[model samples]
Target: MSIPAFADISKSANDLLNKDFYHLSAGTIEVKSNTPNNVAFKVTGKSSHEKATSGAIEGKYADKSLGIKGRVYLLLPTCHPKKGVKLNLTFKQSAFHGRAFFDLLKGPTANVDAVIGHEGFLAGASAGYDVQKAAVTGYSAAVGYIAPQYSAAITATDNLSVFAASYHKVNSQVEAGAKATWNSKSGSAVGLEVASKYRLDPVSFAKAKINDRGVAAVSYNVLLRPGVTLGLGASFDTQKLEQATHKVGASFTFES
Candidate 1:
């Protein structure tokens, strides 16, 4: 293969790093046009070596209860050596004592899910099967019992992976949770994670997590404006102090 230029190599490296490592560094811009009625349009662009852009048009029906969305993407030169599309539909309805939600996603990999819940209890199941690849990519069923003071759930996927999690409301401003997961294919012990969230006030909150791999992270979020928010996050490896990462991100929303 021919050698690549230094600038080209650097750009490609940054593109991959930003895309996979940190969204804050990806340089993404999104614009949603002000429109009337139930129809809306949005366009987004990301600066990377690949130079990717996408456009989406969505519509609401049934008194804004039903939504249909479609997206098209363009990656200069190539996107994964191929071009693809995604279409999704969301429907929500009042069910039992709470609500029911259904989502259908069609794209390179197709998936569907349904969920129903009331106040503090929710049950969900989802499946994703790729016919062209002749593989089952996703399968899981989960049920959660949540109360004002406690919550718990367990999930199993394809009978190969299992996960369990629980949370407790410590007080009005603080909550704590723990999670455990096991993957049969990896032959690893159950991964454990302990996490907590604290709300300093209505506009600011903080989160921290420590996982089985001796990796820990803390993040804080604050609202900068009515429709704008800012986040700062940092992670460190407890076993290796030198292995650490930090990220900063800002999000914006516009309404007519």
Candidate 2:
């Protein structure tokens, strides 16, 4: 669950923060099958860097593996032009929060349940998007074992059968839950950097290179829409080590 980012994506004391919206994915799909047998056509064009990923530490663009890019097994979009129904489904690696120390990596022992969920308009646009989570992720219980399929199949499965309907369970397989929670948390932190990346610049001279190091930082964000947000932020970053270049930054941002 803990995706081992190939490199430290976070800035040290004086790295740079980029303000850019990254294309997590851009793909096209043509329904090969709908309803009944339930199959469809999907084509995806992702970063060709082979090991590239969006929002990596190198900047807010495609960089090396910050962690394994979530696998894109199936991508689908649905909408009712007449009634105004909409849906979005994507499959990618969901990161985990855990660590490897003394040569041992410990984390929530659960495998990333291959996932399939939908969020869309159940009513008018005024109703906004109704999101849903339909996956089988087991957790530990006092009894020692509790399958995601246990106690509450209805809650996890959302009334529809496990492997039926437009929405289906991926059954991606489960790892032990013992450390899954922590690993997932760490991986999720990568998204929090949108808040700030504090950078302090130092005066420099070619004859004598002084402190080249910058500051590094982290922050959390919460929002109902990308167009706007309200969240907490903190950072520690340093100016470009070279001191020859300057980076432009906004503590917060809006499209306008």
1-256: candidate 2 lDDT, tens digit per residue: 2222211111111122322212112211111212232222223222321333222111112223443222224222223332322222223333321221111122212222121222211110001111232333332111011123311111112221111101111122311100111123234421111112222222110110112243333333333344343233232335654553332221222221
lDDT of 1: 0.53
Model 2 regions lying over 4 Å from their true place: 1-36, 49-192, 195-256
Residue 114, candidate 1: C-alpha displacement in angstroms: 3.3
Best by TM-score: 1
The superposed Cα distance between candidate 1 and the true structure at residue 218, in angstroms, equals 1.6
75-154 per-residue lDDT for model 1 (tens digits): 34444665334455555465322222222333346666666666656677777767567676767776665554655666
Model 1: residues with Cα > 4 Å off, grouped in runs: 1-110, 116-121, 130-138, 168-171, 243-256
TM-score of model 1 vs. true structure: 0.59
Report how far residue 70 has shifted in candidate 1, in Å: 6.5
Assess every candidate by TM-score: 0.59, 0.16
